[model samples]
Target: MEENIYNNTYSLLKLIREKKPLVHHITNYVTINDCANIVLAIGASPIMADAVEEVEEIVSLASALVINMGTLSKEHVEAMLVAGKKANELGIPVILDPVGVGATAFRKKGAEKIIKEVKLAVIRGNMSEIKSISGISVKSKGIDASERDIIQNDNLEYGKDISEELALKLNCVIAITGVVDIISGEGKTVFIDKGHKMLSTVTGTGCMCTSLIGAYCAVSRSYFEAAIAGILTMDLAGEKAYKNLKTIDEGSGSFKMKLMDSIFNFNHLLKNIILR
Candidate 1:
């Protein structure tokens, strides 16, 4: 099964090279440029169109659509709903990032609306955010989660159970990212024990991850395969970036640059990346 997962992940990476799927991103402004650049870097074409009037048209031409609720507005949320519903009708995959799902009433309600309206292929978010939406009572500091003081908090037993239950309930792939990333669906759950701590230091990394999942799904029909690959790619890139940053200074600026460089150079090693 492990071998099959690795094979499946590599196949999706190869599809990125062959199909070069077009990804339509209705993401936030904070990481708009990074999201677009990362899409191109991963060998996928990206279109960032969020206006309600043109969203459907843009989605019509895209193989997959990504909607992020990081910097939400009524207009953009409407556009996301329109585009997401249209994508569902067209059989185009849609990935949703419930960025701050538990942070505010507005965010939770907005996320619920999208979930009810769109047939999401996959939904990705942090532990606290995912827990909140999945009916857990974990608290979040704004958009970020508080550290787990207990060592048991990092256990996959809890995560796997939550992921499996939520995936079944939502009828969609659920990706929970943290020290370890888990994707659960269809009575099976997969975990990718990769990624660096520095990844949490930068903002919007999770949002960018949602877009990358969209890019992967654009070329592959299996949402599970696309999601696992997306998480693996993130881990690989972050590990590589940490290696490059080992000699650099410790400012947020330098860390951000190295992270971007890692994603930009990720394609060069995708074929040989190790996925566990």
Candidate 2:
């Protein structure tokens, strides 16, 4: 089953690169452009539509749906709920990014509502957010994690446990992303020990990750396959971009473009390196 999952992911990556699945995103303000650009770089089309008036229609036509609660509003949440229900009814894969789930009561409540209302194919978030939703005892400092003290070597064991717990509860794939990424679902767990610290310096990158997951799931049927593929692909791209940046000047701007370029370059190589 694991081999089959990896094979499926590689095939899905190629399919998305060739077919350019249309992704409908009702995402936050931060990294919205990054999400769209990353989608295009990976050979996927992106459409950002949050209007309640057309969210249903837009979702109806999309190949995949991505909901990011990074910058939440009452109106956008309503639109997301509406679009999410339609996607669920139509069997379109939905990827939820509960960005700052533990940041505030509003964020936590909103994330809970969405998870309960939709059968999300995947939920990707940091340790704090994951712990919050899973009923663990991590105090959320703000929209981001303030307590990285507990993270030792990405704490792979804890990550796997948390991922399994959440996946079992939601009956969906759960990915806890940090220095390392842990993805679990369907009684399977995988750890991706890739990615660079440089990625952490950039804002909206995590949201971009959720968008990538959406793109992968748009083309792959297995939730686990898509989640694993998406994380590895992003990590590989980030490492290559970081290496290239060393050759030139280093800054978010140059690094960002190289990230996209590396993704374009690694499209085929990644498929071959995929564990199967």
Per-residue C-alpha lDDT of model 1 across residues 1-276, encoded as one tens digit per residue: 766766776778778878888999998999899888778877799999999999989999999999998899989889999999999999999999888788888888899899999999999988788888887887777777657611133578888888889999999999988888889976788888777888878878888788788888998878988998888777778887777765555656677777777766665655454531
Q: Candidate 2: where are CA atoms >4 Å away?
A: 1-8, 149-154, 271-276
Question: Each prediction's TM-score against the native?
Answer: 0.92, 0.93
Give the alpha carbon lDDT tens digit for every residue of 97-149 in model 2.
Answer: 88878878898888889888988999988888888889766677776765761
lDDT of 1: 0.83
Backbone clash pairs for candidate 1 read none
